[model samples]
Target: MEKELETTVCEERIFESLYRKLSKSIHDFLYYKYGSNCNPNDTTQEAFLKLWKNCDTVSPAKAKSFLFTVANNMVLNHLKHEKVKLNYQKATTKTHTNVSPEFIMQEAEFLEKYNAVLANMKEEYRVAFLLSKAENKKHKEIAELLDVTVKVVEYRVHKAFTILKEQLEGFSIK
Candidate 1:
């Protein structure tokens, strides 16, 4: 007798089957891509949760790619956020006990303006800009990371810089 195929993840058996089929593969993918230090197991669980949550829109046939893309993007987002946090930590940890209060205030205000400008910019441009300036990554590296061409990265970085310059005309970090 043929078992009924599942059209949605609402079926317990089908969901279990998918878990059995995909869980190890997804775990392995995250492990190899981000290393186990990233907690591939946790990311895998999150990916599965997302799959369950979006099952209505994602057919079983498309679930594999969906899971992989979501997991990869989640890792990228985590990495980007960590990078920003680390940079901010490094910047703030530097001692400036000899600096005047006015200079410190100006620096803080400039940083606020810079963050606001980045937030208002297109995501692509902001990402390229941060990778270039914050991480000191080359355009080619940014292109590889973003899966875009070098020219595209260059354009985004340039646009980001132009926006920063225009918006922060009166402000200087130092």
Candidate 2:
């Protein structure tokens, strides 16, 4: 029991020494990589915690490199996850404007004509068309956000406009 206690004390001393020597550099590197979103202090604290957890595998000489790699990867993964969540929110928002009854009636009439036109379209073309026209997204931006090709976006938009123009030829402007 006494020998085990001494070994634990020695390990703690090694961790403390390594942290004092390398914490500042690790924090600076993370700050440069992640900018404002990654707090230096938080990353430094997390590094020390991780170092403590994996102390057996990390020697004092290599501790800073290990911490920097882990911190950088964590920040990148966080950013990627946030982008996906934001895109989902934007895609689900209602695109049509809402106002009083007069505007509502006009919108309903347009929707009826729009639906009839859309009903004949292939699913992919219909989705691209509605997302572009209703949401006002640019072709390239829509392509990137939807993971489709820009050419596909262009084709769908053109097809949808052709169908709408044909369907609404006799409809009066409200």
Best by TM-score: 1
Candidate 1 local lDDT, 75-144, one digit each (tens):
8898899899989878856555888999999899888988888899999999998999889999999999
Model 2, 31-139: lDDT tens digits are 7877768677786788678778887777556676888887777777778989999998788667566578897898788888778778877777788887887788899
* Worst-scoring 10-residue span by lDDT in model 1: 1-10
Error of 2 at 97 (Å): 13
- Stretches of candidate 1 off by over 4 Å are 1-6, 97-174
Per-model tally of clashing residue pairs: 0, 0
Q: Which stretches of candidate 2 lie over 4 Å from their true place?
A: 1-10, 94-174
